[model samples]
Target: MNIGIIGGGAIGLLCASYLSQHHDITVLTRRKEQAEEIRTSGLKRTVKGETFRASVKARAGITGVFDLLIVTVKYHHLQEVLDGLSTLPRQRILFLQNGMAHLLDLENWDTSHSIYIGVVEHGAMKVSDHAVNHTGIGVIKWGAFHPEDTAAVRNALNETPAQFQMIYTDEWKKVLEEKLLVNVCINPLTALLHVKNGELIANPAYEYMMKCAFEEALSILGLAEKERLWSHVVSICKKTAANQSSMLQDIVKGRETERKAIVGYLLKKAQAQEITAPHLTFFNRSLEVLEKKQTKSFE
Candidate 1:
């Protein structure tokens, strides 16, 4: 299958590096400079201290038809990607964003793409313009927004490399809900506290706050009855104990975080459901303040 991966970020580059071995891949970078660098040096990836470059087509603009279009951009940039692909065929579009916020955008898409959403548990970091480090290996859950997308999703999974495993499921909402629970609880707290993933569970005060924030979010989303949700959050912290949450990495790097898509989306849902989520609301505001500061500094 021919694949066009958008964003060229950590997840994008990681996926391109692995998938390029079996499929023809084209990576779309946000800047001409990065694209040019990839074209000249190829896309590099490091796993377990071993590194190699994969030769793949790299470009700055979206063009031509593809068997699959994997969108690995942040949630805030989803619309820009969609707009750029407006003229192309949307047969098999895969979105690998962080939060459930992009579901609304997908719902409103007036295209013929067999839309699929992937919840990535793998931990990866972009080391440079053309390189990425795969920190932790995890399974990717594939969920289709529509029934017609199952076959495409299965084929994509069938082509998965040995190092990565893909599971196809019909419970997309539950999958996303689980992922959102973790992101809303862990990502913001780590970003705000400027702590590592383990600190959230290891420190008593931070653990208290983590539970408080998570319970409030679960209650608002009516997932309080699901016992597994809390355990899932703790498990993620334990599994990726030494690593920084993506939001914390972004904040530390002075880059924009995905606060709006995760916490901001929950706030809207809480308002619509008439649930008061003070903890989430507080963190959401705090994250916005940090984002604004980062933007001002960049300016």
Candidate 2:
């Protein structure tokens, strides 16, 4: 398949590097400098302390359409990118992201296109223009984002590289809900506290607080009745204990974290249902303050 990956951040470049072995890859980005740097050299994928450069077509703009267009931008940036790619390939479009799909209204995107929501545990960060630091490798769960085109997505992923075989059921909502619970628990707390995730484990107070946040999200998702939600949230935090989530990374870079997309979205849902979201409300307020302060600093 000719794959056009939107957004050349860590995830985008890494996916381009890996999937290129099987499919023809073209990395699209609006960031001209990053795109130029990658085209001049290549992608340096550093995983497990070793690295290699994988050469692929890197460009700033994507014209016409592709057989597959995998959108991987941050949640907040999706709308703009989608609008830019208004003519995005109608077939084999995959959404490999982390967090919830609260960007509702995409169902009208394309009735013929197979929209697949994939969750990646692949830990990667852009160290330089052409370098990506992959902290860990894990499974990717994908499934039909639409009700009827399920088989199309299934077969497309079935023939993908074995590494991407981590593709599983398209129970996208459940997968997203599961990830949202974990993100609520760890992301904001880590970003606000300015600590690596691993450090949070040793602090019992923060650990409990994180657990509380997770429970808050679960309650909002009706997962409070499920015992597995609790265990899953705790386990992911412990597993990625030492890592700094994208939320924290954004803070370090003086950029706005995905506070609105993650916690704010949950709070909105609870508000619509007339349910209390005290913790979420508190976190959103605090993060908003931090964002404002950070913005003023930049100004």
Candidate 3:
């Protein structure tokens, strides 16, 4: 399969490095310098204590048709990417954005394209423009957004490398919701408090605050199995106890966090459902303040 990965972020580099081994990979980046660097140096990936390089085609803008286009850009940049995709020939697209907010945009997408939604469970950090560290190895779970033939997606799933496994699920929406729940519980709190994931469960007051966010999110999402879901969130905190969340990293690096996509989505849903979500609302506003502060500092 000839795969074109959009965005040169951590996830993008990670996918390009692993998938290039089996497929022809072309990474479309936002900056010419980054693209040139990738083309010149190839892609460097570090897993555990070992590092390896994979060759891939790199360019600044989208060109040519691809058998599959995997979009790994953050949600905020998705609209621009979608606008660019409108000019291209129709092809299968798999979105790997973090939050469910992108689903609203996809509702009006062209039906000629087969759309798929996925969540990347792997933990990756961009070491540089052309390098990434695989902090945690996990599978990618995805499913068709609408009723369509999934043979191509299934084939890609099966052909992936073992360490970079992919799973085809019928309940992709559920998978997304569960992942959102975990993010809701851990991300904002960790960012606000400047604490690692374990501290949320380790400190009683922080754990209570996390539960408040979790309960509000579960209510807004109207998901059942409260106890099970709560347990899953706690388990994630324990599993990645030492690591800082992507949200925290964004905060520390003075980049905009995914507040609008994750927490803001829930707040909108809460408004439509007439649910009181004080914790979610607080997290959203607090994150906005921090984002503004970071922006001002950079200026």
lDDT of each: 0.86, 0.77, 0.92
> What are the per-residue Cα lDDT tens digits for candidate 2 across 1-299?
67788888888988887877777788998789988998889888888888877888878875557777888888878877767666644666678766675336366554455666778767778888778887867767877666664654456556665544547675767777877887888889998899988766679988887877876787788875467767776777788888998889988898878897789888888888888978788888888877677554643
- Between which residue pairs do clashes occur in model 1? 90-113
Count clashes in each candidate, considering only residues at least 3 apart in sequence or on different chains.
Answer: 1, 2, 0
lDDT score for candidate 1 against the true structure: 0.86
Residue-wise lDDT of candidate 1 within 166-244, one digit each (tens)?
7887886877888888988789999999998999999989999989889887876777555777888899999889999
Spell out the clash pairs found in candidate 3.
none
lDDT of 1 at 225: 52
Task: Give residue 104's lDDT in candidate 2 (0 to 100).
Answer: 67
* True-vs-predicted CA distance for residue 163, candidate 1, Å: 1.9
Better of 1 and 2 by TM-score: 1
* Candidate 3 C-alpha lDDT tens digits along 2-103: 999999999999999999989999999999999999999999999998999999999988667999999999999999899888888889899999989999
- TM per candidate: 0.95, 0.91, 0.97
Total backbone clashes of candidate 3, pairs 3 or more residues apart or in separate chains: 0
